[model samples]
Target chain A: MSSITWQTVQAEALRRIRTREWPPGSRIPDEAVLAAELGCARATVNRALRELAEAGLLERRRKAGTRVPLNPVRKATFEVPIIRQDIEGRGLVPGYRLLTRAVEPAPAALLASLPAGSLPPGAQLLRLRALHLAGDAPFCLEERWVNPLTAPGILVADLDGISANEWLVQNTSFTGGDIAFGATNADAETAAALDCPPGASLFVIDRMTRAGEALITSVRLSYAPGYQMQAVI
Target chain B: MSSITWQTVQAEALRRIRTREWPPGSRIPDEAVLAAELGCARATVNRALRELAEAGLLERRRKAGTRVPLNPVRKATFEVPIIRQDIEGRGLVPGYRLLTRAVEPAPAALLASLPAGSLPPGAQLLRLRALHLAGDAPFCLEERWVNPLTAPGILVADLDGISANEWLVQNTSFTGGDIAFGATNADAETAAALDCPPGASLFVIDRMTRAGEALITSVRLSYAPGYQMQAVI
Candidate 1:
């Protein structure tokens, strides 16, 4: 307690919670009191409590003060990796194939996901359909749309070897983005490409990115059956 | 930038990166210099850049300084909600049914996931199976193992109306946990409860929690086909 850093404070507070000394639904002392006890600044105590709150261990509200969460739904974070790097990191040879590519008007799906004026009507975009592989096994089927405004290089870039998924990450910079995780039944085309039976369950990731008021790219990656994403909390 | 808060500093820096003014792979000015330019404290610039780095938009190294990430894989965070709250928040009537309950020895799956010395062999545990419903529609199937050592009340508690998922959350407190997301095919038993065809794709969530050195509970939740979890960055 003499070395009253936030890390030390966090450890002490976590020990109390884990041992149930400060039991569920109980409200512990406020920041000032805890800081005085620990011989630390109020900011240090606040930082520790704030982290516990973020970890879903404590719930803090104005006037009500901080209390152990009655229902602690823990958080688990998994990184969203670049496709090529992810495959190669698993000690497998990464490969990619461009199934189709075209320059066309913005699609309905692309228009609906972005803010107004981000992708104007009649705006031209480069559409790419590609398959990524881990060694000889089919990994994922990618359908992507690239807005020429943010990444014009896509208009004439040769994509025979590199996937639009990897290409966009390397060439374009985005200010903000969103990601979606879901499950879907494979259709005829996707099944054939992924070498899976029709109606097989596939894990899907849908991502959208924007660069300073302009929509950069939107892509859907459907993994072959039995894909799992995991992380320690 | 006369009014320079961390928010403003972060905004300006992000705009520069997005517009290619401080292009990717190029080093940016140090915190002291940027803070002086923006007329803010060095702590403010550090805070701003720290957040940008966490968002995968910037890279910070020791003596190497900070730079915009050449391949920014933007992050998106989604909250894992309690099943009842999730259902009720969607304006549906939440319901639960305890399908089965028993006191049994530790299962192989539970033992493998927990830390050593937690859940010793031949330990009698509370096993529960249940179903969560949203407006009469089968929502998810829950299979859970509760460590009686950590939560002894399960032996005498009435689980007729409340699910173990909710009951444990309300009663027991945990120190740490991990969660995993994946896709799996429904088996005959799960398929019947979920009203889905056998071998249909199901979204699966596996979770394990601990209290100090003791494992508290491990559970698996399987959602019927077409379950999507979405979040904005």
Candidate 2:
């Protein structure tokens, strides 16, 4: 009993679910009963059950007790890694080449995608276009717009050496962000940059990070053909 | 003090992080100190800090206290919902049409994806092709292969009214699964089924589910042009 932990209880509960000893749609024992049976504190049992419910293996409703859901919609989590690290993780030499760097007013579409009041009226943003390489081959094309008001350090930062993706991650303190995954056919410019045929299907990730009320940056990465993002549930 | 909860402690910790009071690269106070200051149990403070560490806002090292990360690699979680529920959640009418159904030996590539010993030698799989629609417009094309050994009930189940995606959720109790997102150029058959032009960019999701050692199903869903999956950190 002294050696019992929440993880131990969670493993036992999961084993029961996997073996169908506690079958689907059947209510699991209450927290107090499970605590007594497993020789652990009630809080330990509660924590174990709560985690399983969060993972969609168990269902808990107000005043209805807990049960295994008949149709559980599981969740998959992905760690959004830096592009350079992603390439290096695959045992490839990572390279970056800056193609364009300019300061301009953000487009209306980009502004609409961000949170309201992210930037002052008529504020100029730093725009960067770069290509990431894996083992001397084009990997991904990055198009980014950074709010100078939030990340003013970019004004004098050297773009040739460090990518904005890595720079902001190290310097910025973001409170929250949103991400989206989609597919797009490469236009002529993107195709030329990625060294792929025109209209090739490309996996795309769009992300916007924020610090309190200020928008840190908005960036889009278009991967070369056959790029896949994997996750587990 | 008696009314203090872990949620209360967690909210305070999040506020400190958001406001930069606990700046990046600085170790936070010990759990005992935080508990004493907040008039809560030590376990409650420990739980709150553990969650923040899991969310990538803080870095925790064994024997070294927790500290906010300078370059935090945040995580984004996406709920893998059933296709019908996905359409309905968008305020659209859901529709399904079965395209093909056959029992055949699993393909070599699919067999390689699952865990070892998922199927015995020469086991036949149930292959299904279907189109999911939203508001009379093509939304996605589903290609699924189900191992009959694990899900024998699927063979006798009427799939016309209910998709394998939904049927499996209702009947199967999976222990774990893997998912991947990618992009592909729509082939002729897929283009026709999705009512899009050939070579159109498509968002694709590939998934495999297992119950203990038995593989239940392997599915690939090709979404129509302009479909985007959203997530949050």
Candidate 3:
């Protein structure tokens, strides 16, 4: 019996693509042929190719066979890490300071960003403003509106020692979320927090997380100047 | 005989997580128990759970068993699509115009972005600047440098009608690449191309693609004001 796994088959196929042995726009061998050559099951080869096609690395037609894509629109995965971990990843000390915490009525814009019917009408939200520091330098300013009903623990959680960003990640069980990346001109208040010149361009991330039908939090994280988020494809 | 597949097992596991039947920070049932209950092979259950663990939705410890993550740092996948398709996806007419094409010595910064030893010293690169339009309005400005040696066909490719962004996608086969997203203060030239005021904050994407060890292209895309890149987790 062949003890080869699908991952081994996948690595071998990727090697051929990288080496240009199987050039772009050219059809690769049939699954049965590859299985015979690699001493694996045809099912194993099928599994490997299916994953590669899903990743946009290969193009598979119903009857035309599988070929390397000429222009592959690859999917890049970005992990949304906690701010403290982000700072620590850069070999800097992570510090958090809570700037403000208040319970206020949800704003119309905030309500529009959340899922419809996720929050009750006129529900009050716990708003938090905090600054994350990397080695005594301003790293990011976090402005968050948390649904107290969905995460009741936040109303009583300690905001001085830890950030709402970390606290919610530890307590909430979000089923799904949407995130947006864009650029914003830092206003005077934002510039003061980030310690950048007014009107400087800043990278911003806006996210809304939910647990089932219940909204958990809506947050905007504005990073200091020169912050770049990276990914691989 | 059971007809359960790994996908079916995975869906059931995900449903449990979404419903909070297996609450956060709690260990899920063992593989043997789940297989018996779900009437599937033990290997199927193992495969299903393994995928969830890899996705950061679950935490698996060898001796302690698997538990739902209390603080799941979920990953979001963004697809890098051709600029024309991106415009059309918004239900707008797509237009492209090539502004300039020149062959110039590769700059030190561009060479440093690529993998070391990917380019020979003093090699000339094909530089192309173009504008993408949505319904006759400025959308994005693309500044690209193509390694002529790696993509020789681009030297004579008809870039007037079709953009290098689209043309290269249809011709090049890159194995891996890196992308960075940030904010840039648009200069006078960039602002003119994007139809935005100078010093306005613009979202920028910088990418470097390679085929094995051979660098294929280095490109930067600057999106007009109010542009946002979105993803789901």
The model with the greatest DockQ is 2
- Full-model lDDT for every candidate: 0.85, 0.90, 0.89
> Candidate 2: misplaced stretches above 4 Å?
A15-26, B1-4, B15-23
Model 1: lDDT of residue A68: 87
Expressed as tens digits, the lDDT of each residue in B33-121 for candidate 3 is 99999998898999899989978889999989999987677777888888887898889999999999999999988877676788888
Root mean square deviation (Cα) for candidate 2? 2.1
Q: Which 10 consecutive positions of candidate 3 chain B have the poorest summed lDDT?
A: B165-174
Indicate the worst ten consecutive residues by lDDT in candidate 2 chain B.
B168-177
How close to the true structure is residue B196 of candidate 3, measured as C-alpha lDDT? 91
iRMSD of all candidate structures = 2.2, 1.6, 2.1
DockQ of 1: 0.60
lDDT tens string, model 3, A113-204? 67688899999999999999999999999999999998978999999999887778766667788899999999999999999999899999
* Model 1: per-residue Cα lDDT over B1-233, one tens digit each: 45778999999998888678998889999999999888999988998998889877899999999998777765556778889887887899999989999988987877876779887778989889999999999999999888888986877889889888677776776666788888778889999999999989888888888877888888999997887776677
lDDT of 2 at A172: 64
On TM-score, the candidate that comes out on top is 2
